[model samples]
Target: MDFCIVDWGAISSIAAALIASFTAIYIYFQWRNQKGAEVIANEAKQNIQDILEIIKIVSLIRQKSSALERSRNFIDFNRLYESVVRSSLYIDDCVEIKDFKKAIDEFFNCCLKFKEFESLYRDYAQDSKFIAHVDSEINLIQIRGFNIVNTLIPYSIYQKKFKFRKK
Candidate 1:
């Protein structure tokens, strides 16, 4: 009787192949997961940039409001109104910022009423009641805008003089 010997070499080769295949699959999945993370990080960065841009627009509107308060005129009010309309584009995706937009709309409406008042009375634009109303509305818009911006950005950034404080 002749005894046949099993080929250990062939068995070892097959085991090695299986291990290599599993390693390749594991590496491929890891790469895919890494790519997905990179995409999400990029999107978050873009969102932050958009929020920053919107904050800048709000700041511009606030500055214009101050200028309008200093020199009340149809031209400055018209410019500020146009700026408020332009800012709507930035606040489209931001639901929290929508309140600020509503405030801007209210401020714009007040400007229109002031314009009408100026046209009707000419001298009543500087009346205490009208001036007070406009100032209050502007102040409200500024406070709301500052709060919204502070919520979006980090405290470090705000602490570095990027914050808007009521004077």
Candidate 2:
């Protein structure tokens, strides 16, 4: 007679544990990926909103207005600018976004120059030279602002839904 020992019970137990572990790990990863997508989508929505508000404020700055109205515009824009800067805390700032920020800073500097020019020479506000300067500023802003808009457009969540086109 020959005697041999085999542990079938132990082998089955080990196989079951391994399968359970693998399934758990797979589920965990899938959940994590879903959460990540949600976060990115939320961030995109927020960043796009901030950018649009900034653009609108810039538009206001371009328009000719009374000194009091311009002062109100300044107040509004200051608040918007601060919000945009604060948004960087949650937003994943890409190169285009960073460029947009730099553009905003430059615009604020231009705004200051305009404000001073208007204050010191209120009569000159309608002068050809001042009007020409404002026009030149508008021209520069059009070029720079549109370029940034192009880059940031891709980040908008509603592009596909709204059927946006590339220009």
Candidate 3:
């Protein structure tokens, strides 16, 4: 009878050990899955941030283009066109995404139209009254776009260089 009781005790202990080992294995796999999920979530967040920055930049470019269109007579179209070109290059070099191509194409179209008006507006820069104001506005637009581009740079390097500037 004592031998029978000892055998039962040993069997129960082995059963408990087996259960604990299975539980530990299950927990490890669950932890691994959770870690992978967290990594995916973080990547998604980063992608969203990048997309948002691109959207804001595209909107700013559109607004600038609209302003230039309205100020055709008041602004130096050729200089404004050149500013747009510079911004396009900045976008292309800084961001590899193709979504900006449309905004860039619109800007190119504006440049082409400005080319038609180039012969007329080319000499307008010599007129001190128009040149001064146009140059100021052009500089403002260029600065705005350039600052926004600067913002798109990774937060690590970008923040170091452009800490106080608002985009």
Quick one: best lDDT, which candidate?
A: 2
Better of 1 and 3 by TM-score: 1
RMSD of 2: 7.1
What C-alpha lDDT, on a 0 to 100 scale, does residue 29 get in candidate 2? 82
Better of 2 and 3 by lDDT: 2
- Over all chains combined, what TM-score does candidate 2 have? 0.57
Per-model root-mean-square deviation over C-alphas: 11.1, 7.1, 14.0
**What is the C-alpha local distance difference test score of each model?**
0.47, 0.56, 0.46
lDDT tens string, model 3, 57-114?
4334334534455345334444544554665554444434334455455535533543
By summed lDDT, which 10 consecutive residues of candidate 1 come out lowest?
158-167
For residue 120, give model 2's deviation from the true position in Å. Answer: 7.6
Query: What TM-score against the true fold does each predicted structure earn?
Result: 0.41, 0.57, 0.37
User: CA shift at 136, candidate 1, in angstroms?
Assistant: 11
* Ranking of models by TM-score: 2, 1, 3
The residue pairs found clashing in candidate 2 are none
Candidate 3 ranges with C-alpha deviation above 4 Å: 1-6, 65-167
Q: Model 2: per-residue lDDT, tens digit, 72-109?
A: 76677567656655554334342224465566556455
Residue 82 error, candidate 2, Å:
2.4
lDDT of 2 at 139: 57
* Model 2 lDDT at residue 134: 64
